[model samples]
Target chain A: MRVALHLAYNGTHFFGSQTQKETSKTVLGELENVLKKLGIEQKVVASGRTDKGVHATMQVCHIDLPPYWDDMEKLKKVLNKMLCDALHVKKIIHVKDDFHARYSAKKRSYRYIITTKQKNPFESDFVTFLEDVNLQQIQQNIGLFVGEHDFRQFMKTGSDVKSTTRIIYRAFAYQHKDYIVLYFEANGFLRSQIRLMVGALLTLTKDAIQAQLNGTKKYKIKPAPPNGLYLSKIKY
Target chain B: MRVALHLAYNGTHFFGSQTQKETSKTVLGELENVLKKLGIEQKVVASGRTDKGVHATMQVCHIDLPPYWDDMEKLKKVLNKMLCDALHVKKIIHVKDDFHARYSAKKRSYRYIITTKQKNPFESDFVTFLEDVNLQQIQQNIGLFVGEHDFRQFMKTGSDVKSTTRIIYRAFAYQHKDYIVLYFEANGFLRSQIRLMVGALLTLTKDAIQAQLNGTKKYKIKPAPPNGLYLSKIKY
Candidate 1:
């Protein structure tokens, strides 16, 4: 039977969500290790891959399980016990055999957190600290990416994708206590898309951003660090 | 010249605040390693030592420096550059030659954070989450720790302290958004005393807590984990 697992990970411990060659630590590699120990040699597929140092609060994945692992509660307990604290299976449910974690997703949401306060040791890993920022300026330009556009310039330099066009369902900025959160919802995003958009929002003017969205201006934009980015949700 | 430095450390990457024999990744050990590289071979004296995984936001330490390293700003910049991200020197100021970090401290403040929400990977290291807790009961019992008392029962075993009694200037609990913060201000604290007191506050009845403070009750109380405890401030 196939199972859909709701997962959450700190992401600081793992190299990234995707498994890599050689014995590098990644989210899938760690999960598969525990599954093999439980006598279930199955591969886990994530909804999407997250970059290194990125966190996830509601990342979904699909895995096939044997008949003996019918008790979902017991399976979740066992998985959590064996997995390290940085990774966890929040919930597990039976899914249709054809349900694919990556392909069946209709929407994905990402959030980038920014702190204007002085950098503190406790929050350094989760929130990006900026010495100076114009909140009103960023908020005004964030809505420019709300509609569908070809985000070819915003994609990471070396990534290969057949299509660079994606729909942005929603994009906005809000203040939550001490942090400013940038929320982006889309049907899909290219590699490093959100970070690049956030970087553009921080550095480029309104006209520059529009030119980039129009694919008329090609500027070398640096993607924001992954520490402040979180894969918040995936909807099917 | 003697200089007092205000420091902050995440503590998750550190074994403890004090230096240990062999190659241990300790706060002082890391700090001293950087100091030695700067050619300042003086030992650092902290206001107090925190247990493994106990964080500090304003831990003060005193170190004597050579006259060649007279630029305080330059010294701070060099120190921060050499130290790891988990450890930082927040501020530096010259002090009298007789000044000492531990001996001159008049009061120390510690804060314990408790979250009633479900455990999440993002906040697992900074906040202690409990599934079920009677907040009102813990609040009412926390006041019993105020004032002077024989806290021998609340200290960690095998700790060779000169005295077990200390004056508690203030003790209270307050709500901070999603967290319940327990604050304690005292002239001094024995090793793991706050954690033990917090454990009793959570588990023991009000009468039992009073008995423990009076030295009439001796319960083998397990101290709360160090991850949720922070050495917030030290006043001299």
Candidate 2:
């Protein structure tokens, strides 16, 4: 039987979402460990990888389970008990055998939050605080990210990817209390593109760039720090 | 000039609220270091000490500065920027020489929170999650805490305070979403008294103890773990 799990985690302690040798603290690794405790192994796959210190509000993953374990309510309880803290299993549902968490994803949305208020120790692990940023400028710069563009310049240099062009469905920036939240949705993204765009936007807002510099001209955008970015949702 | 600063900190990273020779990574120590950078040294004092892993929503402290440095707004910004991310200065105000951070307090309030749902990493530093708590039973037991009471049995063994009796102006437990928030206001508290009360209440709610096991009787009550308690508010 095929199963889909909607989940979220605070990524501060993980290496990243993808599994790596020796350092098996990734979200997938933890999920797999819990699955192993339930007598299942080698049956899980995630929607995508999130960089270290990145957070997620909703991420989808698919797993293959035995036919006898069909009661999702009981499974959720068991999983919740086993997973305990740090990770949460929001929902569980049976999916078509051929459904893929990565391929079936219609759009991915991300948010980057920056704060100017004095440090909030309670939220330090989840948000990035910037001492300087002009609100009006950041709101203005987000408009440039709404359309499709050749985002090779936004991609990290060492990222292994063939294409750099992607369609951005929506992009905007707004203030939520003390935080400046940058919201972006796209059919897909090049590696580190969101972070890069955020970094560039912050730079633009700070007036770090000269007036003659064109931020959207493909060669000038820099990736934002990883801590501020969160994979907020994935639509299937 | 004398200034009293209202502050808050996540005590998980600090040893506690007070600075000691062996445990110098304390909230007061960090603030003192920042003060030294501004040419003020050894002139800091806090209202009281909060134990390790005990958070504060509002902790008060006072420091003496040069008479010429009378700009409260500038001092606030300077200290907030200089302090580490784990400590924050919420508000600063110039006060008369007679004002003492510790002695000027009229009352102190604390809130202990416990969640019946799965652990939330976002709130890990702020709240405690108890797996099996009957909210209805806990709610019913809350009325037992109101008014003044001799709380000797509810306090820790080595507490050498002058009095065990305290005036509780408010005491109640309420459910908010997945969490149960327990609030208490008192002239003062004996060490570990709130934690002990909470632990006993949880046990009673779970049927681990008979309903007759109130602290009013001569009985020993175990203190809940330190992570569940917070020095939520200190009034001056």
Top candidate on TM-score is: 1
**Candidate 2 global CA lDDT score:** 0.79
Candidate 2, residue A19: Cα displacement in angstroms equals: 3.9
How does each model score on TM-score?
Answer: 0.80, 0.77
Reference contacts preserved by each model = 0.62, 0.69
In TM-score terms, candidate 2 sits at 0.77
| Interface alpha-carbon RMSD, every candidate | 1.2, 1.8
Any idea what lDDT model 1 has? Answer: 0.91
- Per-candidate TM-score, first chain only? 0.98, 0.91
**Candidate 2 chain B worst ten-residue window by lDDT:** B207-216
Residue pairs with backbone overlap in model 1: none
lDDT for each residue of candidate 1 in B104-123, tens digit (9 for 90 to 100): 99999999999988777778
- DockQ for every model comes to 0.53, 0.47
Q: Could you give the CAPRI-style class of model 1?
A: medium
